[model samples]
Target: MDKVIFSFLGTTLDAGYSAGRWERWRPTIALCQQEDMIVNRLVLFHGGGHDSLLKLVIEDIHRISPETVVEPVRLQIRDPWNFVDVYSALHDFVRRYPFNTEDFEYLVHITTGTHVAQICLFLLIEARYFPAKIVQTSPPRNSKRVDKSEVAIIDLDLSQYNQLASRFDEERKEDVSFLKFGIATQNSRFNATIAEIEQVALRSSTPILLTGPTGTGKSFLARRIYELKRAKHQFHGEFIDVNCATLRGDGAMSALFGHVKGSFTGALQARGGYLKAAEDGLLFLDEIGELGLDEQAMLLKAIEEKRFFPVGSDKEVSSQFQLIAGTHRDLSQDVKDGRFREDLFARINTWLYSLPGLKDRREDIEPNLDFELERIADQLGKKVRFNSDAKKSYLQYAMAGTTEWAGNFRDLSGSLLRMATLANSGRIDEDNVSVEIQRLKARHQTINSDLGVDESGNSHQDWLELRDRIDPFDQVQLAYVIKVCKQSANLSDAGRNLFQQSRKDKKMSNDADRLRKYLSKFELSFSQVKEW
Candidate 1:
């Protein structure tokens, strides 16, 4: 019996089948089923689609490989198009299903479109999913042939695909670099802070706790640490990020540690949890403060002992992952309130760093704004420039207002993106600045109230009122003296200004002495008083 393997690529399951692309797939499917041939098992992979397509692909594989075993893998790729998920799914599939080329003679990949095919090719080279020869099935540009069998097979070696994948990865990596530290981009403060955090990441095996206001770049910093650590050493492990808030009660334990088959009502098969996925790499717990007290206790044990038993499993699994925890809440306060474990807090706090808010670093605003604008322009595929007046006005507006930036870097990036979209000729004017500032004030009014300021303007008003309240007498006296001197200078037509208004105008020399005494009380020289 012959053996054949097929990988189907498409935007969605139905589209690949309905567009007559399934015809090309049929040839590979038929080849795998043929007895006395060089084919036996048929492997099919689907990408990015509704579940209906996945079911259809599985059914098709079963129909083609009745005598031979059929293995089907469907990757659930998240939108906003993150390739990490695809790589992870493919790698997992390869690990579980190791193929023997001696039994299988042909391995074919049927591609739906350019991008889907390109990513799969990249994953193959980087992940080394299979040792079989790789080929791409490209449709004829001007032909009306809609059958999968009509698809052209382009033979490609590992090196050629590897180079292309490397270039693709490099381009993406470069783009992500802007999201990294000290790059002239939106959220540069967060990026730079994250870069600094990464430096200390590898120094100690202790768990790290990143505390900051929401959207202050906690997750970003954690990811950077993982990337840095991965670069420092060749660790074949995954960086698994989990939101502790989402994992309530049993779900928390199930997600952290693996669950045995029939462990719970929905445990159809034994599943490895995030701890197993992370292995030798970093496991980031985002919003760690939101974890319930019971869940916290479980997590603390895992951190301290580097082991956790799966839910409903008697066996203890070793999880030697580098724990990177982050939270927007004050964990110490949570501990005092008996909401968080003190021991857990102490363990994670061994390496702690607080990120400064956007308001604290006003100097970075202009540069960050420029970098964000450039990014927005590049993404929109349009050229944008800030007019001199608009630029000055916007900067002045940014400087004058005390925006706490409750959302921090994320909020700033969003505001800049909106401004760029609405700006005329890429020029954000004073009017635009004013409108955006008002919007920001309205958006954060509750936060402002909590901080004891109704708005930035109100803060400025309060400052003026406080100054008046503190030195009411001094202000009144200074104004009165300055007014009198001006009047005297005008009346006498003297070359020099008057020192002060005499208490007794008719007393002449007596009044002069009194005024001199008054000047001395205020630590003013007679000559200086005259100048004043």
Candidate 2:
């Protein structure tokens, strides 16, 4: 590969312009002589206002080494100290420069120009605006030593440095911790998943699909990923997050793909939608399973083509944005049921991570208590603390097998907010913990009770009481089945509804018989269903 040097023009005003006299050695020229290897070309950035100095520098480069090709780039800027102006000018200049990384090896001379200009160059390099290494030049102590000598080339690849690499790893851990809101979790699998996510966020723009139960922090993590990417200057636009579950029919389509003026009943003006709003940024679709088929088709097209036509608009609008989708529902199952598009699922499934539910990451619960408390304090302007007894009591109950956190982090957050609000003198006592625990239990019991209601308004609590009676997998499935049963007029109706889509592919003679036998395994029947 041919060597190419990218450097800024340093003023030679310090050196007298007297005939047959030179005070200082130019850093750009010195950059060329640092190593024995010949630099094939030089891409030099110069202030457009300084034409004479530029000419003199070009002459000096030719005098020192005529074989080296010089490409002078004129950048207009009033002040080097004005970082915005200098950086913008340099950024535009480099962007317009046709760079072929495969054929030429590039080196940025960080030694020349004002300190501000050097910093901007370094930032551009770090942000990968150019594929190059930095080179710094120093003048010899004895001015009489006119031969350009002192120079050091800097390689910004930190992975090569053991100590610096370790420091970076530590900082990455901190970043992951911040993403989790300081939840000091010890679960190895969960920690490893987070580490993987961190890598994906930094390295790839591929659509990420976060799958997990509701309130499992999928949306939170998606937003955090956007923040991380934005902080790194990977994205310049705002993060657009939309919960797909709340969208319905025309509203869903319009909100996602936008609508033209007079497109629908209420679209009075041309709407830009979430996609256009997230141009050059990130779009996090929480509960992505709920989007309608037509919307999904359009979304698939947009993801692939980076352009889509707004409703009732002939013109196609373009948007380039990273996508992060979150969902509690099994999209594969949805695809099989013909509710979700298989093509869309396949497109987003490339970078999929299943975020663990609160039950799975129980170790994180304790630290989350403090996080919640701090969050509440900031919002309410009142500080609160869980006393020793209260803290132990709450943790014990929360960590126990009976305490099913159905709502996951949302449940934990709500529990802490209530306890903190009810605390006496800014301290939550054992009584407060006990009351909150009982309240949570009642709320959960009420939900389970609703699934197993009898004719006489008795809470059979079949699902509630069977906490440790059956396998957790069976327990969850059966609970859902029973819940559906409560809404049906009869066992046959419940069975048909439950297997409405799945039974289509099966040669089943009696859906009711199949459901009945399944219920018998759990000692449940239709007669038990009424009002929980």
Strongest candidate by lDDT: 2
Indicate the residue-level lDDT of 183 in model 2. 79
Worst 10 residues of 1 by lDDT: 491-500
Model 2: clashing residue pairs?
A: 453-531, 453-532
- Total clashing pairs for each candidate: 10, 2
Alpha-carbon RMSD, candidate 1: 18.7
Taking all chains together, the TM-score of candidate 1 against the true structure is: 0.49
**Cα distance off (Å), candidate 1, residue 378:** 5.8
**Candidate 1's residue-wise lDDT over 126-161, tens digit each?**
444665555444443564443322333444463578
Per-prediction TM-score to the true structure, in the order listed:
0.49, 0.65
lDDT of 2 by residue, 1-532 (tens): 8889888887752123444434456577666654475878988887877677777778877877787899888788888799999999989977887889989888898887889999999998887786788877787765566455576778787778999999988989888886776778787878888888998899999999999998888988988888888888999998999999899977888899899999878778988999999999999999999898899999999999999999999999999999999999999999999999999999998999998888888888887888789999997789999899889999999988657888899989888989888888999999999999889978877876666532223346555576458886876777677678877888889889988876888777688999988878867677764354
Q: Can you give the lDDT of residue 222 in candidate 2?
A: 87
Candidate 1, lDDT over the whole model: 0.64
Candidate 2: lDDT of 353?
Answer: 93
